[model samples]
Target: MNPTATLVLNNGKSIVIELLPEAAPNTVNSFIFAALNGVYNQHAIERIVSGNWIDMSYSAFHNEKAKYLIPYESQLHPEIEPLPSIAGCVCMGGYDELGLSGCEFFFTLRDCPEHRGVYPVFGRVIEGIDELYRLEKVKTKPITDFPYKNVEINEPIQPEIIRKVEVDLKGFKYDRPIKLPSQVLPKCWAMEYR
Candidate 1:
C-alpha cells in the first residue's frame, strides 16, 4: 500500500499527502526518511506565489539548510509514465545541471504547464488542501534588499511553520535515497542565494 504523510502546521491545521512510490521511487524514499527523522519539524514555508505553489521542502528554509543532492528522477526514469503538475500535486525542486534537491518539494496551486519535463510529480494531496490554500494567501515579502528580476521573494511575513510530519509506512520499507556524489549546492547558489 502507498504511504501517506500527514503534516501538522503550527496553527493546528494539517495537510495529508499520498506518496507515489512507483512514480518517483527515490523521491518518495527521501521524503519518508526525512519525515520520520524529523527533517520537516519546525521547517519554514519559505516561498509562496499566490496561484503558483507552496515551496515547502526547500533546503534554504530547512533547519540544517543542507543541500543534499539526488538524481533527477524524471530525467532518469523513463519507464514510468510522467505525471502532470495539476493542482495538489507535489514535486521535487532543483536545477538540471546540479540535480534535484534530495528533499526540496513544492505543492502546485494550479495546472502548471511550464513545470512539465522539469520537476517530477511525486505526491498528491489526499486531504486538507485548504490548509495549504490558507498559506497561499499569506502576505509575502522579498528575502533581500536588492530587487533582482530573477529573485521574486515570496517569504511569508508572519512565518508559517510545519510543526511535525508523521508518515504511515503501511508495510513499505522506505529506505533512504541514494545520495549524489556531492551534497553541497553549486557555487552559484552560494554567490547569490547562499
Candidate 2:
C-alpha cells in the first residue's frame, strides 16, 4: 500500500505527506501508530531555529517516553534516492551520536540540500506548505523559564502549534516509477547507474 495522505490541523492548515515505507519501515510504522493513537494530538511545535526549520519536540519526546525506541530504519536499498530537505519536507529527528532519530521531527521551510545523505527523510508536505511557511516566519523567544525545561531548552524558541496530526492512507496508490516531491527523483534515479 502506498503511504500518502493529507494531515489536517485544527488551525485549518494541512500538510500532504508521502511516506516511504520501503525505505524506512520502522519509522513509518511508528509515525502511523502515533497518529492513529492520538499521540500527536494537541502537540505544539516547541523549537524553531532560523533558516533550519521548526521542531515538534513535545510529540517526539512524549512518544519516546511512552513508547519504546523505534529501530533505525534508514534507507537500505540503493534504489531509494535521498531528497533535499525543502520547505514542507518532513524528516525524522536524528540521535546525537547515533544515526537513528528519536521522536523529534523537523519540517523544512527552505531547501536544505546539505542534509541529503545524513538524515532519514520519510515524507514530504504537499499541501499546507504556505501555512508552514507562515509558522516558520513567526516571532520566537528564548524559553528560559518554562515549566518543562527540556521542552524549553530543546526548543528555546517556539514556532506554531500542531493542533493535531491526522493520518490518511486510504486509496493511496503509487507505482514503482513514481517520483517523490523535492529533488528526490534524480537521487533515486541515479542509483540505477551505481
Candidate 3:
C-alpha cells in the first residue's frame, strides 16, 4: 500500500500527501472517506493567513456538518505526539471545547509553533510544496456585506479551488463512517451567521 493521496488543484498543480494512519487513524479514515466520495472536489480555499497557513473548507463538504467527531487525537493518542505545524504538514481544524474536529483542514505555509499540540497533525506533503506556497500567496480581496454592514475577511480575489482529491488505498478497503451528519456544519455555526 502506497498510503499516499494526491491533491489536485485547479491551478495546474498537484500535491502528494503521505497519510499517517499510525499517528491518527480515525482522522485518516475520515479523510479517506471524503476523498473517495468526491466531497473535496471543486472546494475553494476559504481562508489563508499570510506566511502562516492555508485553510480549506470545501464548499459542499462544509455545507454539511460532520457526523462523527474525532477525539483530540494529538492529546489523547500518545503514539501521535504533537508536532510543530511546519510547511506542508496537514492538520485538522476543530474546536477543542466542543471536543470535536470536522472536515476543515489546513497545510502550514511556514513553521507555526503556535499550533503545536493544538491541531491534530495527520499527514505531510511528500511532493509539490511549491504549489502549496502558490496557493498561500494568492491575492485576496475584502468582502463587503452591505446588508450586515460588516466586512468579510480572508476571501481570495481569484478563488483557488481544490479540483479533486485522489487517495491510493494500496488495496486497503475501509467503509465510510457510520454516522453521517445531515448537514456537515453544526447548528451553532449557522446561528453565528444569524
lDDT of all predictions, in order shown?
A: 0.79, 0.58, 0.69
Full-model lDDT, candidate 2: 0.58
- My TM-score estimates for the predictions, one after another, are 0.89, 0.68, 0.79
TM-score quality measure for candidate 3: 0.79
**Residue 14 displacement (Å), model 2:** 1.9
The model with the greatest lDDT is: 1
Q: Tens digits of per-residue lDDT for model 1 on 82-152?
A: 68889999998876687877777899999998877678888999999998889888889866642334645
Clashing pairs in 2: 81-188
Please write out the lDDT profile of model 2 over residues 13-86, one tens digit for every residue: 77778777766555566577666667666766677766667676623444433233333443434566666667
The TM-score ranking, best first, is 1, 3, 2
lDDT string for model 3 (80-151, tens) is 676667888998776555544546677888777887777767799999988887776779865443222332
> After superposition, which runs of candidate 2 have C-alpha atoms over 4 Å from their true positions?
58-67, 75-81, 144-159, 171-194
lDDT of 2 at 71: 36
What stretches of model 1 exceed 4 Å from their correct place? 64-66, 145-149, 183-194
Superposed by TM-score, candidate 1 places the C-alpha of residue 148 at a distance from the truth, in angstroms, of 8.3
- Cα lDDT, model 2, residue 152: 38
Off by over 4 Å in 3: 58-60, 65-68, 74-76, 143-153, 175-194
